[model samples]
Target: MDIEKTFALLNETEPLKISTSREITVAVMGAGSRGNEYPEYGKLFPGTLRVVAVSDILKSRREAMAEKWSIPADRVFGDYREMLEAGRGGKLADILLIALPDDLHYEPAMEAMRQGYDILLEKPMAQSEKECRDLARRQRETGVMVAVGHVLRYSPYFRALKKAIDSGLVGELVNIQHQEPVMYAHMAHSFVRGNWHDGKATTPMIVAKSCHDLDILKWLAGRRCVRVSAEGGIALFRADKAPAGAPERCTDGCPHEKDCPYSAIDIYERKRWFLYVFDLKRDCPAEEILERLRTTDYGRCAYRMDNDQPDHIVVTLLFEGGVTASFSLDAFTPWGGRRTRVMGTEGYIEGDGKTFTLHRFRTGEAREWSYAPPEGGNYRDSGHAGGDLALIRDFLRAVDTRDFSLLSSSIEASVESHVMGFACERSRLSGTKEDV
Candidate 1:
């Protein structure tokens, strides 16, 4: 292996230069966080991509997006069906981005493909394995390009990690250990009191939250997972764990609000984090923010919400070639970055989202690759270490050239992780191994 070349791949921080033959038009189905991300790429590299239409159930999100992209009134619809229907026969745009909730991915994506538009569908493909496979088959039948939201594969950190392993830094990989810590505040906001609280109601926590990790494990291993076993349960956020005098809602003046870690007051009013969910800006006035909290699920006490997502889970995966992996997801944590260790015959690698350390047994040398923000700029400009924008760049090039290989997260490549996730849930429920 060329040691210098491997380090270059790891430490390289140059911008992903993308020059497309022509502008690509996009129609968005959801204007939430993910929706805001993919469309902004068009603004960054104007004429390379354009937002021609948008649709959202939230009127504010719909109106805000229309104003952001200068989308005409006729191009914005309250229901995604109207937008997809309008685009019938591929008249609306060149590509469609389905960034709606977890439950809505498969159906809308199928409809968009049938409408003759290529698509960039959000993660977990669908709620079940059958739906995921159905979407893949649909993409094949339609011959429309389909990009799934497995954004981590494009991130600088994971890209470097994969390159290092491929370069033989970790020779003959044997085992992997990965952990995903879903920060407490995020769990309370999104799972405990938000849309993904019930595993059965939406997608299971294994798929909804950790499918990306599973996908990464498979990608890094260079094989498919053959079997999976798992176990987990909700431990902290149940109603039985509520404080003695806790009210149904934190704004109802629970005595523990001042001290509780999961208090909505602390996360929203005091710290002012996760406000994007409400479509509110960080600079929005505190009183208005408080009012929104008081009326919405965001204000409810985490322990009192009627939610059932597992707070902790551990999975064992066996990939082809006897490669094994151990994965754990826990909700009681300070933040949401993944930690991983990959072990092989010749060396081992350890990573914590921002930095990776490689240890070679042959040379007894240890090296580290650390991420730094772009010169004179902050990483906040893009998510997932700039993976999101990088993916947009590749998707544009793919659409322009009629080359599906440009996509790392295509439906066929991304579905295996969903299979592993469903198998894990099955193992968890049946107390036995599940085949994939």
Candidate 2:
């Protein structure tokens, strides 16, 4: 590809094509939570950043987001490549915010880099280890700015914890214990019977949801995970458990429709309806989604869906420098945040998803703080805990400063997380410890 021509093509599509200065224009590769980069980093953008384009495979999703965000219709593309091609045409955007599905991050990022666009990629960088390495290698070769979606690194709670650790508030870090329940309803709704039903589509559960924990563990230990031992199985929600009279499609006289907690109608159509019904209301009619919920495999009773991923997982990680960490994800918990207990030689830290408590042996006292993010800093507000905005801001800074190292989760860091994820999966399957 002619880099300069591609750049020109993208720039030509911009609303204000005549004048250019230090302002950074961005194109969101996918209209997922990572696409709404405004909420996370808008405070810092001021008049310097602009969201010029957005793309997604679903026309309704793209159009709905574009309309909501006031992006010109011409800037929306069903294909991200076409969007990038336009960017290449005339400098449409300086950075690419990649919030596509887990399996779709690599190609668009590589293409964006080839055309000289910086990248802000969502977590789990790519579908496989090889893809992660390729992206990392390319990033190294091109020296293009790339920031991974590791939002917690920028959060206040974690920042404080890191400071305390460095200051010996927690003394010498020892073993860490944490539990991240996938939540039965959440796993059944999203991972098992929901959109990401196949491991191929989303790797394993660890990578899909708990990569953040893995990243957090790494950050806290300040050491790499050397090995991982895990055990996980599909403890619930299997095809054999379908109700006797349940239809393959819930629309047809399912006996459990009214009372089953795992009912697809209740989960997707009635109780949890707000997500698809409210969020994508502009594109997907609530009734239509409800009707579809009653007719498709996605509508099958949660317990009866063809779910293959584990519903419960236990993982033990051995980090370099003898730091041991244990993590569990149960699929039956109620909707809540997360809980973590970090025990060090000097003190211990306990977090119950909503709040965290740290005890220092030096003082024999504990300090506690709520884990709630600021009111507007949440992504669900803008889309995904405001991670997109923060990600975008970081990418823009890297672009303007020509500093690829500015990545909060550099490609190398992201790859290491993926490697740990793979190790966890291997241990889950083989019932043995796997080296990271």
Global lDDT of each model? Answer: 0.87, 0.70
Q: Which residue pairs in candidate 1 have backbone atoms (N, alpha carbon, C) closer than 3 angstroms, thus clashing? A: none
| Local distance difference test, candidate 2 | 0.70
- TM-score to true structure, per model: 0.96, 0.85
| Native-structure RMSD, model 1 | 1.8
lDDT tens per residue, model 1, 238-274: 8889889999888888999889999998999899999
Scored by Cα lDDT, where does model 1 land? 0.87
In model 2, state the lDDT of residue 24: 73
Cα deviation of 253, candidate 1, in Å? 1.7
Name model 1 segments beyond 4 Å from true.
11-14, 372-381
RMSD of each: 1.8, 9.4
